[model samples]
Target: MNIGKTLFAQVMEFVPWKTFGRIIERHQGDAGVRTLGCADVFRVLAFAQLTWRESLRDIEACLAANQTKLFHMGIKAVPARSTLADALTQRDWRIYHALAQRLIARARALYAQEPSDLGLDATVYALDSTTIDLCLSLFDWAPFRSTKAAIKLHTLLDLRGAIPAFIHISDGKLHDVNVLDVLPVEAGAFYVMDRGYVDFARLYALHQAGAFFITRAKKGMDARRVYSAATDRSTGVICDQSIRFNGFYASRDYPEHLRRIRFKDPESGRTLIFLTNNTSLPALTIAALYKSRWQVELFFKWIKQHLRIKRFLGTSENAVKTQIWCAIATYVLIAIIKQELHLDASLYTCLQILSVSVFEKTQLSCALQPDRTQPELVSIANQLNLFEI
Candidate 1:
């Protein structure tokens, strides 16, 4: 199947085009006649993200230069900059959102076997959000400050393979803690977070839904230690205790005892207090799970550096959302490819290879994977290790 096919074409084989077509139909993405439909726009935007195209003109120029390979790449024709911009502005962004959700489901199934590295059997999720600043003039819809505008990406990251389980886009004014109101709670799963999301009311909501949470407790939180649990001091776990809120409002909000872990980081020598509803796991594992929340932070940093979300191809709310969804779909797609192909190469390497070799008429495996029949060059002991976790 890889014979005589471009790497880009083969990479796209993972996409469920028929399903996306249904999504487009449901959204009526092509209700009106146009030079560029929603699907075409997605392909172009995905291509731009993969190839690191800086602007609309850059995308148009690149496609124009490779005009002959358009069909093979699934693009019927090269789109003019104006036409593409119009599509981005008019087409429903929900089409791409649905597509991205489908890709996420498929990717999650493929990566279900991945370990969380916590050595715990329960499902662990890292909850966080990152803000992307925008110019107030260009993005009047998203208001961050008196003069600045921005958008926030609220993400729930499944630590296994770092696949995003849930994503919500909102104006920068939206508080991170507010995301808990819309967060889908799965029973018995562990949700880790920082103190910014430490609202006792929302935490109780999660508790009521039969979900567990591990988050840093805010300073000056009034709580009475009801029972002190035994702990090993050498593991950096200072003390593990069962605590109940001492404040009237806090007690009313969470009318239940919570497990509290006090840990001192041997490396940083910083004492930390962690709050969680899960009482089964060891205090060390709880601390380690909190430490793993950094993966979501790294996930944010990685996509911002590699994807096109930092810069806007269009100014409309719909356009920006569509672009971000497509970028998410692209990231999930590449993650799917990496798993299916079983390539030892990192994602950064895979993207680097595809950036320049997308149009080449070669087998995807041969192009992405090193030749087994030939002698291979030795990899250095220390390489450019980027985002391995």
Candidate 2:
């Protein structure tokens, strides 16, 4: 099978560079490099991922080989490494953040259309964060521990499509709860989070906003008696009591009507508690939903392992954010192609095809072409007899 001419070329065609070009053009201002518009920067960013270019010099070399593709992506001229680096450092960070938000919105819309096909419910979103370790001495102000220097990437992923709906980056020392404020939680959406994000006030706000959440509660929390003893069938734990606040609780910043569930983890055999405003579902259902929170961990593994996020070329926070966003953007692009081509392949398999097809001198567009009708993905799956039901 001619992998290069089929899969790789097809994937490249799916990148929505036209939409990105428009976003960049609309946001470019009197930021000095007006000639170097958003499209140029975006093209450089996409190419960096597509080629696995180490630095600006490497980007220039890749562009030199395919100047036409750059032009197609809206670059008037290729800027030097130093010039690009200066622009990235001095240019307004808001512009890039806004672009990321736009891309995220687009991804959300695309995923929302066919949730069932992607194995997701409308309300389920997986929330988690991963640490991107860095060189502590250089990025000293960013903070670091004795053994590892890192930054945290907190993401709200729409599990239906494995697309990131909200993302934020912070110093490694920042608590996970601190990043919760920026998440985009729609009314009636179900948010699944781990113990690190166990904040009463935030969960309260979510409840007040008419949103539902399922999270593992901290071990030791104080609550008054509303119900004497109710057995939680899932973990076989008896609920001690439920409480309602007369006024707002300052410690948790919770409103008057928050419901707390006290339970235990069956697998770990440890006492586990959960706090939620959702009363419609039984406690067992809530426990089951929280168990599915492991999907976000799988996402972290997918990106770090498949996309090669561990080998970062930039040490600056902005540079790191840019790289991570690019990787996500690439993942989204491949997902779109997989759906469009009607390929019943797992995302990991698609990513492997993408990695080799793009970086191994094989074009992404060709590899993903429908007309070729190779069915390499199905053949491999059938040979392994991978379970797809």
Candidate 3:
């Protein structure tokens, strides 16, 4: 409950910063002026997450003032703006990519547990993407932002744990369906996707892998019934339907795998169409499962609002990728802390706590050695009237 216990500090202690430093050293591979080590670069990235500082100068200034605190966090010295900027601009992005993948894999290992016994026939994952607008004049080559600037962050989120399992970044012009091949999918896992990702070939690939999926049929697609629908007594929703696609049904080889789930929208008094390969479950159950995909949208909202990710400090493609990945890394750290604390706080609330407890203090001593404990945190929460415990 002592949320003031610098979440970033606590979580960073767990990450192998030294190993990352070694990675950077190795990447340098018999180089010149030494430059900044990986720890220093990570410090800057971590600082960006702890505070929404957008520029290298701001980070340098903050670190310079809090040198002792930075030292505690494993930063040897505050690198100059020029140095940090050059390091970011020149450093091989593949190193960062490898580092990120390693971090995610480690987190998954730390948090993995037996699948929840929800008695559901399948586990569900959701897929979606959000646009991170950039400066068109600055990052000119970025795709889909010919008039304006933007990048797409496509993610596959595990619905049960509200955790992102896989993430990919592409130019703004990239279609959601095109990124499907890059994501990791398990055989029994169910994927719920928005209309933007409706591609017959990709869906068929998932079907071929023995995975299940539910998606809204595009408006113009034709549907032919294979079985009469049974009505649900409580919700008045249709129970089941066998359907044939207007086009060559990609999954035609697996005829028994296709089913239609129909439900009336409570708000509009209109019927919603959902196509799925899962036939063992009832129609309403499929609808309910697909409905959970909205959680990914909420996750996007949380990141955009809480992480201050709308603005970009770097102009080039690499800089944009670095900033976005750092933001995600930050989010993962916060989520890990929330799990460690056994607190049911929302991500924004947790970030707010971290911002106040870590970044607001001018001195590292004040920030790290705050005389706050679980009781004090509870009291502060009560005084601040934060009911999101």
Candidate number of the best lDDT: 1
Cα shift from native, residue 87, model 3 (Å): 1.4
RMSD of each: 7.0, 7.5, 6.9
The superposed Cα distance between candidate 3 and the true structure at residue 44, in angstroms, equals: 1.2
TM-score of each: 0.94, 0.76, 0.83
Query: Can you write out model 3's per-residue Cα lDDT over 285-337, one digit (the tens) per residue?
Result: 77777778899999888788777467765666776666676677667766665
Candidate 2 residue lDDT tens string, 1-389 = 34433343445455565665565566653245655555456556766665556677777786677665444444667777776776665555455566666666766676677635324354687888998777777666568587667888898888777888787878789888887787776998889888788777877777778788877655445555576546746665547445664434534477455556666776787666766677766666666677778888988887777674676645676666666666677677667666666667767766655544443444444444425456665345436545756
Instruction: Give the poorly placed runs of model 1, Cα more than 4 Å off.
Output: 371-389
Candidate 1 TM-score, true structure as reference? 0.94
Relative to the true structure, candidate 3 reaches a TM of 0.83
Candidate 1: tens digits of C-alpha lDDT, residues 80-144: 88888888889988899999999999988888888657676678899999999999999999999
Winner on lDDT (2 vs 3): 3
143 in model 3: Cα distance from truth in Å?
Answer: 2.5
